[model samples]
Every structure is written in structure tokens, then in C-alpha cells.
Target: MDTLSSTVQAWAGSAFAAVFRGIKVVRPQRPIHPKGIQLVGTMQRDDGERQPSGIPWLDTAGTNRVEARLSRSLGLPDAFPDILGLAVRFTEQDRLSDMLLATTGPTGIGRFVLRLRRDAAAAVFSSMMPYKSDTGPVLIAARTIESPGKLPVDPAAFRSLLGGESWTLELHHATPLGAWTRFGTLTLKLAKHAEDTAERFDPVLNPLPTAGTYGWTKRLREPSYAVARGRG
Candidate 1:
């Protein structure tokens, strides 16, 4: 049994290596300091047109969410502390437009709003505070003209990028310590816009049904009852 198990493990590893050969393994390069924060957000063009560059627009009606993890070393000096995670979501109508999410030392400072021109490039970053506050100021760490890239259509690549695997790799490489640290993976899923119904009134957006609700029995039973009751 042991020999069989080892052989299977070896075969699986070899298969994975072959499949992923020449594919770059994406992972965070830094230990995600308490002063450093990662930001991920989706933006859409207002005209309902997608730019030639590959960036997809997030639905305007749904809230855009952001997350960050911050951490600091403790008395044990050189070791890295456990990470604390923070997150926030804002919609287009929210007062916090043009804002950059910031994290400093296990805390989330309020977002800083900036002027951004359409078709222009921009970068948002979190900065450390010189003074103490519940939430500190995050300055512009870097900026550039917005040149979007093409969206990945491949299911495997897309899934790998969206999964938390990259973040997990970075955490594992970091030296564990006693101090409090911030660490978390941020994710963004774009929502589709709501449509107006035939009555000219907007219908409440229905949440996506769960897999359990999609059983064949449930689908068949519900329709049969409606038909029998003359309610279809």
C-alpha cells in the first residue's frame, strides 16, 4: 500500500509539473509589512463600451469591494507577526469616489479621494503615518497613466489568479513571529447591471441560487405544482 501511494504521489507531482511548465507561478514578493497594503478593484467605462485594453468594467450599481492585511513585528524582534485583515466596499453613489483604500499597522485608514481623469493612468497606494491615529493617511505611493491589459479568458488561468493560492504562498514563506500582523487576500467579482422589466418598474435583483436549490427534483417539482395549481 505504501509503495502504491508513493507511486501515485510521484505521478501526480510529475503531471502537475508538466502541465505548469513554462507557466509563471504568481505570488506576492514581499512579506506584506504593516505599512504596506494591497488593493484590488474593478472599474467600468460609463458609456457601456469596453476599452480596447482588456480591463472589464465592474457593474456600477453593485458595490466595489477592497481588502488589505497589515502586520507588525513584536518583542521577538526579527520574526514576522500574524496578519490582521481589513475590508471595505463602496458603490458609485457613495461619497468615497476617487478614493484609495489604505492600511497601516493593522488598521484601515479612511480612503483618500483624488481627482482622476478619464482615459488617464492612475495608481493607488497605502502609506505609513508619521503620527498616531485610528486610521492614518495613505499617500500616493505611485501613479501612472491607465493602460489596461487584456482580460484572461482561459478558465484555468483565471481561476488560479482569483484563488487565494498566491497569498497563501507569501504567508508560508514569511517567518512567523509573536507580534500582531495583518494579512489577508482581497478578491473582486464584478456584478451584472440590473435590467428594467416589461412593467417599466425595476424588479428586485435576485441572488444567484445555490447549487442545492438546482437539483433536478426541485426544478421538476416546483414547475409541476405551479402548473397543477394554474399559477404558472
Candidate 2:
């Protein structure tokens, strides 16, 4: 972006962060995922046959213990129309790698522009948000093995859709590298508590190999995270 646009975005991001902080003073426990369940799982990287992409996190093959959380974006009660979310966090060699996806389309740094039912079987989750990669701007995406079906509004069906099966999740490299490259397979095993309500998910804390938040991501997401953390 040019200087003028960049300046405007920075101002806007600060303003949004301020607004979020103001809200937190009143409702400190309110998180982006107000209503959700936590799970324990594993992320197994694909075999080393893939070419190196210069990003250390993606250029290797191995399985790591993962902590995942599933939730309705609005934190609404069950059976309501809300966006579904999957936040995965894992550690490799004592470093943390975090990725967040939602039941929204790929290719935007905006949020809630499109509202889709939280359907598990038919759900398509994208990094929806973008990141500034060492290679350039990129997003991640994942879907279930089952074919798309009728949208289910119930929580039980939604939980079954995600927890019931092993699914493939991918990291989409920017244009020159390619789109939708295999990242890993996520196999969630059991339900667990997140323990700390104050700890919210932030992509900025991502591992070095896959860390970056471009202009749009910062303007649109950082403020909310700041607000959630009472740092705004």
C-alpha cells in the first residue's frame, strides 16, 4: 500500500484497538470465542517430498502435539446462526506455531462480512484472515472428507462433524509458490479445558516459519486481539 493508505490504516487500527479496550474494561472475560470447547490433538506434517519454501516451519516433516479449540464466533448459545472457528496451537523444539481458521471464504482480511452456518460435514474453513509470509501474503485452508450436505444448526451435529474424523489442513503459499500446499493432518482426540480465559488466540504470536500479519490483517484483527487482552 502507498504512504497515504498505510497511514490511514494505522490510524484506523489504533482507533479500533482503543474501542476494543474500552469494551474490555466492562466485560473482561468476553473473548472472540465466548462460547467454545477445547480439544487435544496432533498435527502430522506431510512427507519431506515437498520442495523447500524458505519458511523453516513448512520445510520439514514431523508430528507435533496440538491444542485445538472449537467455537462459535459469536459465543451464542446452540442452534443459532454463527460462524464456526478452529484455533490450533502446537509446539516444536519449544517454539509455538499457531493458526486460526473459520467457516468463511478464502482471500480476505475482513471479518463477519459473510455469515455461514456452523456446519461440520459441509463446512469449509479458511485462514479467512491473511498473513505476511516470508514469501508474501498467504492464507491457510482445510475441509472435511465428507461431501457437503445440508447445513446443520445444532451443536451436537457440528461437534460430530469436526471431532468424528481426521481431516487434512493446508497452508496456501502466495502466487509464485502455489495455492493450497499440504501443511498437515489434524486428528483431534478428546475434549479439554483451556484453563485460562484470559489467554486469547493471536496469530502474531505465531512461529517464525509461519509468522506475519500484513496491513489488512493488522488493521482488522490486531485491535480486536488487543481489546480482548485489555491492551487496547
Candidate 3:
């Protein structure tokens, strides 16, 4: 991780540390999603057949325990019109699969352009965030069973759905770049609150579920996550 990008990553990491420490004296550094709710659930594989990505962790099949967090992107109140977040953590054996996603508006990230900056502009906005796969690049998204083809869900609706329903996380292969096709299904059962925990979700801490590199996205997030974790 010590190439030119890593150098930049280190600089970025330090910059974040400075800001985090500066803020620690007062409010504490939770950089993003400072306000959120944690939940416990399970990720069950869909019975439908899957096109192998040759990525063992992804193609390996089965149900697993899931720890999740749902929050407002701005750490706003439950009724505010802000991007909603869903971060799910899956652990099988000693390995971990964790993902953090923020709602990309009603139109989804498909309509947005990828901008590299030090703010929200750098954020990846897609119906599903992409990952490296043996076949190529892949992305994933979670959809409520109650709604079809609609997304960036409403706060009230999201709450109602979690009462007793499940969501389907669809994996897609990014062939032709953004032309994604179904690869697998990971069902997120209803979430229940997780109490008295301070775990932060940082994708860089874990290995990619598939092949290829998730470097750019991880680089973009590492600083922010470091800042958030520094709060404690």
C-alpha cells in the first residue's frame, strides 16, 4: 500500500487525524453518520442460481449472521430529507464482509458522475457500490421486498418496512462498465437495534469479497473513518 497512491493516502490520513483531534476537544469526531441505529440480522443466500464471479467469498454460498447500522447521512433527525445509510456486516468463520451504503436519491447513483474531492463530491453514489470480482468489477444494492425498482427510500417507509419485512441485496457484474447484471442475492432480514456499541464500519479494514482492487473507494473513505473512530 506504499505506492504514490499510498503516499497520498498517508497524507490524507494525517490531514484527517489533525481535524479529528481538533474536533475531539469539543463534539468528538464522528465525521459522518454520527447519528444512527445499529441492528442485528442474517444474510441468507437467494435460492436462485448465481453466475460465479470465481471469488470464493462471494460464490461460496450460505446464510450468515449480520450486524447492521442504519443512519442519516448528515446525522440528521429521523424525519429530515437527507440521504439514508445502510451498513451491513457479515462474518463467516473468521472472515468479514461489511458494506456501507448511502441512499443515492430517487434516481440512484446511476445518474451521478464520480467526482474526486475532499467532501461529499468524492462519495460514490450508485444504486449499488462496486467491488472487484474475478470476472471483473461488481456492485451490490439492497431493495425492500415491499417496493420494486424504487430507491433512496423514505424515512417513514424504511421504518415501516423494517418492522417485519426483509430486503434483498442484489449483486451485479459491471460489464461494459455500468451495465450491471444479476450475480447473486443476499437477503437482509429485518434489523433489530444493537445497544452500547461503538464499532465503526470501514471497508478498508477488510478484504474485498471478490477479485480486483477496491483501493480508490477505500482511499477516499479511510481518512473519514479514521477521523470518526478517533472520537473515542
TM-score winner: 2
- Tens digit of lDDT per residue, candidate 3, span 30-142? 55556655566666554557666555666665677778766556545544455666677877668786676665422335423332211122233343445677666565544
**How do these models rank on TM-score, best leading?**
2, 3, 1
lDDT of each: 0.25, 0.61, 0.54
Model 3 per-residue lDDT at 62: 69
Candidate 3, pairs of clashing residues:
none
- Segments of candidate 3 deviating more than 4 angstroms: 1-29, 47-49, 105-129, 147-161, 167-176, 189-197, 210-212
lDDT of 1: 0.25
Best by lDDT: 2
Clashes of each: 12, 0, 0
Report the error of model 1 at residue 187, Å: 1.2
Which stretch of 10 consecutive residues in model 2 shows the poorest summed lDDT?
A: 168-177
Per-residue CA lDDT of model 1 for 1-232, tens digit only, reads: 8667656655654544433332212211211221222334433223333212111122111333432221221112222222222222334433332222232222233222222211111222232212111232112222222223321222233233434322211000011112212222223332223111111000011111110112222332333223222333
Flag regions of model 1 displaced more than 4 Å.
1-34, 42-78, 97-232
